[model samples]
Target: MLCKIPDIAKGVISLFASGRLSTEDYREIMQPQIESYRKSTGKTYIYVEADVLLEGWQHQSLAGSGQVQLPNFDALVLVGGPDWFGNAVRLMGPFMQGEVAWYPLEQKALAIQWIAARTDSCN
Candidate 1:
């Protein structure tokens, strides 16, 4: 299940995923709040805690035909997850419009702080 991590700084959306994350979870649970915030606020900063995924996004059948609109982030901070996943995200950093950062699960606090600091730059 994906649960929102509360108490995060304003302008930043944080989510914690602990089990299988289905497209339904993203579209039904995650998307609405994200789109709502994006529509209200011009920029978006996202933080995700992905240390405990029973099945990750790569295992999902999400592809071309029914692609959904994703929020354009100002900063994307990912904490925890497999090493390869972290590496892939880091490698894709340059190709992404927003900044991408990865941190170990243990450094979650630092990752949140980093994202919060990034949000401060826009203000």
Candidate 2:
């Protein structure tokens, strides 16, 4: 499951994730943000805090379904699980089209700082 975090700055969004990921999670919760950015000619800054990876076939589909709006992103900061989760992020980077980064679950401040730095480079 996924949900958008409210009250953050424009062009930047925070999302919390738990349980198995799915295409529906993106379609329902994330696609709207991409559409909104496209209409406004703004780059997307997506920060996701995930509690778990997508399970079963959902994990495989992420490689395909995940990149539908590939160019819509400018920076992606993901915070979750172990330090190796960052490795998982890099492993999955080819399936994405932005700066894909991961931070330990407790280093949210660092994650936010990294995303803020990339905001200046957004197109």
Candidate 3:
């Protein structure tokens, strides 16, 4: 399930995913934010909490679905997930156009701080 994490900050949308991730959930919950980001010229931020990496998800398809809008992101913070997932993202982070940070579940505050610093969102 994907649930919106509300009241975090202005211009920032946070989402939490549990159990197995679904493309349908992604579309219903996340795609709107991505669309809003794409339509707006203003800076915005995103935070995703998908702590576990469950089997049966095609990671590439989920990622590929957002490729067009990825470059327009102001900043994104991801909290938790497996070490390998974090490592893979970190490896590609430097090459991406926007700032991307990953934090352990315990360091969620730091992830919020990092993304807040990059956005004009009043948190």
Candidate 4:
């Protein structure tokens, strides 16, 4: 499942991914949000919560496609397991040129706050 974080007031767009993620899920949920963020902020900062179930070749292929579809963002906050963090870093390396920070799921608030602050300063 994927969800947008509530209570974030800045231009930074946040998402939480849990359980299994599918290509259809990305098209339905993430794509529209990314489009909206681009239209509003010109740049986006994404915060992704771990607990993601990255299973199946189709799911992985969809994730790769989604990465290509994303707009240039100022930063990315990855909150999850170390393995997930490492995979995300490798996958997103090419698309990201700005700051990328990782923290455990326990530090979700800190991650959000950091991304918000970074986005603010960048703007």
Candidate 5:
């Protein structure tokens, strides 16, 4: 399932998802949150906490808006997913305009704090 983490500060968008994920989850759910945050802050810190990232049909949706709008984010904190998820994220490094890092799910608080601190430094 895909849903937003509540009460995060403005410019900070955190999503918690696990189990199965689909292209629609990104296109429908995650994309809107990114767009909304971009419109408000012009810069963002995105935190994604997922167990097993992509499942059947989910990989296809990973293609985001190419290089366009890449500068929307300042930092990206990803937590708890399979090794493939980490690799995939690193592969997107050249395309994404944010600093990316990963951590175990148990260190979610640390990941969040890192993004918060990095977001402040980037400003």
Candidate 6:
């Protein structure tokens, strides 16, 4: 399950991944959001909550490669369980050059606020 964070004014794209995440799910759920962000701001600042069970080598490989093709962004916020959070950071680190922030699930709201503020300052 993925959702955009509410109340942030910038073109920030957020997603929450829960349970098993397949490649098809990634494409179906995330691709549209990425496209929407691109159309809105010509870039995307993606925040991902890592509460998912990642499966299949192919899915992981595709995710790793596909991230490189993502539109430019201002930042990425990763929030979730510690292990998954670490994994998410490791997987997505290379593709990210802008500010990157991470927080535990308990701190998601704060993370969003920080990201929003940071986005505002950058623009």
Q: Cα lDDT of all candidates, in order?
A: 0.77, 0.70, 0.71, 0.69, 0.71, 0.66
* Backbone clash count, each prediction separately: 0, 0, 0, 0, 0, 0
Candidate 4 residue-wise lDDT, 14-123, digit = tens:
77776666666567777788789888878877887767464322546455555324455678777775465557676767667777888777777888788889877867
Cα displacement (angstroms), candidate 5, residue 69, comes to: 9.8
Q: Indicate which candidate wins on lDDT.
A: 1
**Tens-digit per-residue lDDT, 23-87, candidate 3:** 76666777787678556735657888776753324476467666323435778888887766678
**Is 2 or 6 the stronger prediction by TM-score?**
2
Question: Candidate 6, TM-score vs. the true structure?
Answer: 0.68
Runs in model 1 with CA error above 4 Å?
58-61
lDDT (C-alpha) at residue 113 in model 3 = 81
lDDT of 2 by residue, 83-103 (tens): 556787889887887777888
Global lDDT of model 6: 0.66
User: What's the ranking of the predictions by TM-score, best on top?
Assistant: 1, 3, 2, 4, 5, 6
Off by over 4 Å in 3: 37-41, 53-56, 59-71, 121-123
> Per-residue lDDT of 2-38 in model 1, one digit per residue for the tens?
7787847788887887667767778876787678768
State model 2's lDDT. Answer: 0.70
Clashing pairs in 2: none
Better of 1 and 3 by TM-score: 1
TM-score against truth, every candidate: 0.84, 0.74, 0.74, 0.73, 0.72, 0.68
TM-score of 3: 0.74
User: At residue 112, what lDDT does model 4 achieve?
Assistant: 77
Q: Which of 2 and 6 is ahead in lDDT?
A: 2
lDDT of 5 by residue, 1-123 (tens): 677777344467888877676656666777888888778767778887877643423444445734223245778878888777777777876677668887777887888788888767755
